[model samples]
Target: MDEINSVKIEFLSRSRNESFARTAVACFAAQLDPTLDELGDIKTAVSEAVTNCIVHAYPDSLGRISVKARLFGDSSLEIAVRDWGRGIEDIGAARAPMFTTGGDERSGMGFSIMESFMDKLRVRSKPGRGTTVTMTRRIASRADAR
Candidate 1:
C-alpha cells in the first residue's frame, strides 16, 4: 500500500559540507509536502547529525559522511547520517545535555536537538568502526488535518 522514495549522498567529512548535507535532505523531503515548520525541523535535525559526523567522526583527518533520506507513503520521513571515521566511545554521555568532547568550541547539544525535532532518533556507534544517527519525523501540518 506504500512506496518509499529515497536519496543518498556521500560527501567528504568537511565542516563546510554540513549545510549542504542538511539542505539536500530538506529538498528531497519537500516532495512530501511538509509544512514550513516541519521542513525547518527536518533541516535542523539533519544539520546536527551531519555536523556531528564532520566534527567528531574524524577529529584529525578527512573521511566520508553518508546521508540517506526516505519518504514513505504515510507522510513520514526517515533520515540517516553515517560516518566511517573514528567511532564514539560513550554514546550515553555524548547524548547528555552540554556534554561535549570538543571542549569550549562545541555546545554538546547535537543529539539533544535532533531528539527534540524528530519523532524518533536512534544512534549507533562502535569505538573503532563509526557512528550512524537515524532520525524520523511524521509530516502532519495543521493545514492538512482538515
Candidate 2:
C-alpha cells in the first residue's frame, strides 16, 4: 500500500500524555474524514495503548514512548505506539482478556479494548527491551461526504 501521510511523536511515558497521544492521532486521522464512531474508536484505542505503556511498560520509572500514525490511500488509519521499558515476558498471556499483571487496580483489558476498537491489532515485545502496539482502522468512504 502507498502512504498518504505520516507523523511521529516521542514523549515520556506519563499518565497525562495518554490523552495527548489520543488527540494527536485523532487530529491526524481527521484527514480521512472518519465518522464520529470511527474517531471515538481511534481515540479509545490510542488511549488504551498509551496507558498500557505508562502503567505497565514503565511501572516504576519514566521511559520514552513513541507514537507513529500513518494515513493510507484506502482511507485506513494506522497508529503504532512504542515504549522503551520493561517488555512483556509472555505476549500470549498479556493479550488474553482479563489477564492483568498490574495488581487489583487494573482490569487487564487494554489489548482487548484495542483489538475490539481497531480493525487490526499487532503487538510486539521482548523482555527488558520494549513493546510496540500497532493498530489500523478503515474508515468507510461516504459518497455524499465528498
Index of the highest-lDDT prediction? 2
Can you give the TM-score per candidate against the true fold?
A: 0.95, 0.96
Candidate 2 achieves a global lDDT of 0.92
The superposed Cα distance between candidate 1 and the true structure at residue 1, in angstroms, equals 8.1
Tell me the tens digit of each residue's lDDT in model 2 across 69-146: 999988888899999899999999999999998999999898899999999999999999999999999999977557
Off by over 4 Å in 2: 144-146
Quote the lDDT for 105 in model 1. 90
lDDT of each prediction vs. the true structure?
0.89, 0.92
Residue 72 of model 2 has an lDDT of 91
Q: What's the count of clashing pairs in each model shown?
A: 0, 0
Question: For residues 1-146, what per-residue lDDT tens digits would candidate 1 score against the true structure?
Answer: 26588899999988999889888998999998888888999999998998888788888999999998888888889898999988988889999999998889999898999999999999899988999999989888557787
Candidate number with greatest TM-score: 2
